[model samples]
Target: MNPPDVAAAVVVGGLFAAGCYLLLQRTLMRLLFGFLLLGHATNLLLLIAAGSPGAPPIIGAARIGDEPSADPLPQAMALTAIVITFALTIFLLSLVYRSRQLHGNDEVRDDAEDRRLAENQQREASAAAADPHRTNGSGQARTAADEGGNTL
Candidate 1:
């Protein structure tokens, strides 16, 4: 391969790496940007691999005995890729918008407090199910007073 082709490959590879890194981020915008970068990197790699341009790939009486024309397969493939990427970009953008609207935030984060609360609730529910109406000696539901008034 030529120097230009090698450079293109390197750049495309770098873009792909960056895209992959960005895609792992929690933010939806970063994910969308990563996807867009990945699409461009793929298109660039395809273009570089197709070789330099020459004559059009058209068969006519004027060139019946000429050398092989430029291959349009890569170009066609790139076009299809671009169209698909565009559609995906639109879909992803819409998804990001909907997520932002519903969550009121774009960055994804774990709701630790919510998870803890849910776990506690589940524990309490299971305890209640196991002992429906088992009251302590003081006729109260296991309070600090029953445990010698040691505030937690």
Candidate 2:
């Protein structure tokens, strides 16, 4: 097959870039739109990879000196991709719906556990700074005199 057209390549790249940007957003709606865009882009790429369209590969439909019979593999793959995209889109839609119902918004919120963990780490760091090398695991620094006056 001949080399791909520059315009088609640019369009596919643009679609993928835009879709990734949207998918990284905090809102479900934007993510859904991105998913759809990516799906379309994938379908277009597959069809383009199949090369210029030709008559279906039929035993009796062969024409001399005409376009080479089209390969059905890419077409079949593209069709399967379309179906899978549709199914995943539906799943994402349901997730968006459930998120809205539970949180009253489509925007994903930061996880509380993550914030708590950060706070704990900060507190531990401050404590470590305040008491460097205090080994007994107590607020009061360990001392030989304090250990029953051993004084060793």
Candidate 3:
């Protein structure tokens, strides 16, 4: 392939990789940046998929039987995507701002119930370690206290 096409492909790959990495972060700001990168990558891919640039679709721009006219559909779709991405970006930014204001940080918080469950598991583990004969919620012994839940 040509140098330009190769460069574009590399850029698209880099954007996808960076976007995915940022998307996995805990902060809303990074997530926003990730989404933007992903959106741009998508737009570029759409343009590339639409084929090489050609003359504008205007009448008389290209001879009737000569050079081909550009396809308007991909251009329209890309434009629509850009607008939607902009609107969503604004909405997400406002959400992130409000989250920071309310929580004093932009990091995504863990669910309260999940935290409580993890704590409960930790406590249960410590308790079982302390008492070898203790049984858990499922009526199974923490140690080798019984076999098949029955004693001979």
Candidate 4:
């Protein structure tokens, strides 16, 4: 490959890494920017997949033994990706706007449900450790001291 292609690939890789780091941040603005970077990287990667450029994909424009016309498929795919990225970017922007309006910042708050589920998992793990023979997720088994109509 040419130096330019190699350099472009390197840039794409950098963008991907930065985008991923930003995506993992707790701030919505960072997330939005990260998403944009990833989208741009995707578009560039798609174009790169097309290899060397050629004459615009004009049917019957190529002469005998001449360089083939550029592939239209990758160009079309890039366009589609751009549109999808644009739409998602707008959606993310709106979400950031709403978050700012409600919370005066773009930071994502901890979800109560997520916390509850984590706590439940921790409890279950402890219970299982306490009872190695327990087969069910509840980590409880029938005992002589317990009286009930059903296991429930």
Candidate 5:
């Protein structure tokens, strides 16, 4: 590959890695930025995959197989990706604004049910630790299901 192609590849890789890292963050703004980076990376990747740009594919502009013609599909796909990304940006911005207005923050919150389940598990662990006979005859740790045979 040429120097420019190598640079583009490195940049695309960097953008994708950064995008994934930002997406893992627990904030709406970061998530939005991550998506933007990913979109850009995708466009770059498509452009690179389309190969070096050449003469326009105009009808009768050139003899067949005389000169390499630019691929139209990659450009079209990139344009479509841009439009979709723009729509997603608008939607995310509106969502962030709504979240700020309602909750005063864009931080993603965990579900209440998940917190409750964690608390229950902690309580069960503590109770088992405090009980001398909590273990079964085989010295295996007993679970909530074993005690009451109840499935929540």
Candidate 6:
């Protein structure tokens, strides 16, 4: 209802929107960023839902009838969320690093073309190796074929 609350809500909404957009990207880095943003947005939403800070939730026996204390539930929830997010981020970063190391690239691409080309090349190579008369280029196979009969 207040200006600060409205601003927080807007920021939370913006972060969620940004996270969704980044998650749709084809790069691992973008996806990591999206997850981070989403985590932050969730924390912000929890904070906004929790009332503003006042006093600690501790109460003495004699001060039991004093005033209401700050709610610790949201704060605890936020802390737990933060810890979980940290773990997730670390795991995701490791995955991204491993992927880049293995593939030499971070972007997700269709491997159908590459696989097809490799398979075609393999088939061609096998065919060439199988044919005795079809000597592959430079001397070696040609010499062997020449020594043998001119048979197919």
RMSD of each: 9.7, 9.8, 8.1, 8.4, 6.1, 10.7
lDDT of each: 0.78, 0.80, 0.79, 0.81, 0.82, 0.79
Q: Judged by lDDT relative to the true structure, which candidate is superior, 2 or 4? A: 4
lDDT of 6 by residue, 1-152 (tens): 43567778899999999999999999999999999999999998998878775567766534445556778899899999999999999999999999999999898765655655555566556657777466453245345444442332
Q: Per-residue lDDT for 14-95 in model 5, tens only?
A: 9999999999999999999999999999999999988887788677775567677889889989999999999989999999
lDDT (tens digit, per residue) of candidate 2 on 13-126: 999999999999999999999999999899989988987777787778758687688878899999999999999999999999999999999997877666555554565566
Stretches of candidate 3 off by over 4 Å are 1-4, 61-66, 125-152
Ranking, lDDT, top scorer first: 5, 4, 2, 6, 3, 1
TM-score attained by model 5: 0.71
Task: Compute the lDDT of residue 26 as modeled in candidate 4.
Answer: 96
Candidate with maximal TM-score: 3
Q: Candidate 4 has which clashing residue pairs, if any? A: none
The alpha-carbon deviation from the true structure for residue 128 of candidate 5, after best TM-score superposition, in angstroms, is: 10
Q: Lowest-scoring 10 consecutive residues by lDDT in candidate 6?
A: 143-152
Tens digits of lDDT, candidate 3, 45-90: 7777677666788875646666678787888999999999999999
Clashing pairs in 5: none
Worst 10 residues of 5 by lDDT: 137-146
**Clash number for every model?**
0, 0, 0, 0, 0, 0
lDDT of 4 at 94: 97
Model 4, residue 52: C-alpha shift (Å): 1.3
Which 10 residues in a row give candidate 1 its minimum summed lDDT?
A: 137-146
Q: What is candidate 2's TM-score against the reference?
A: 0.70
In angstroms, how far off is 76's CA in candidate 2? 0.4
Q: Candidate 1 vs candidate 5: which has greater lDDT?
A: 5
State TM-scores per candidate: 0.64, 0.70, 0.74, 0.69, 0.71, 0.64
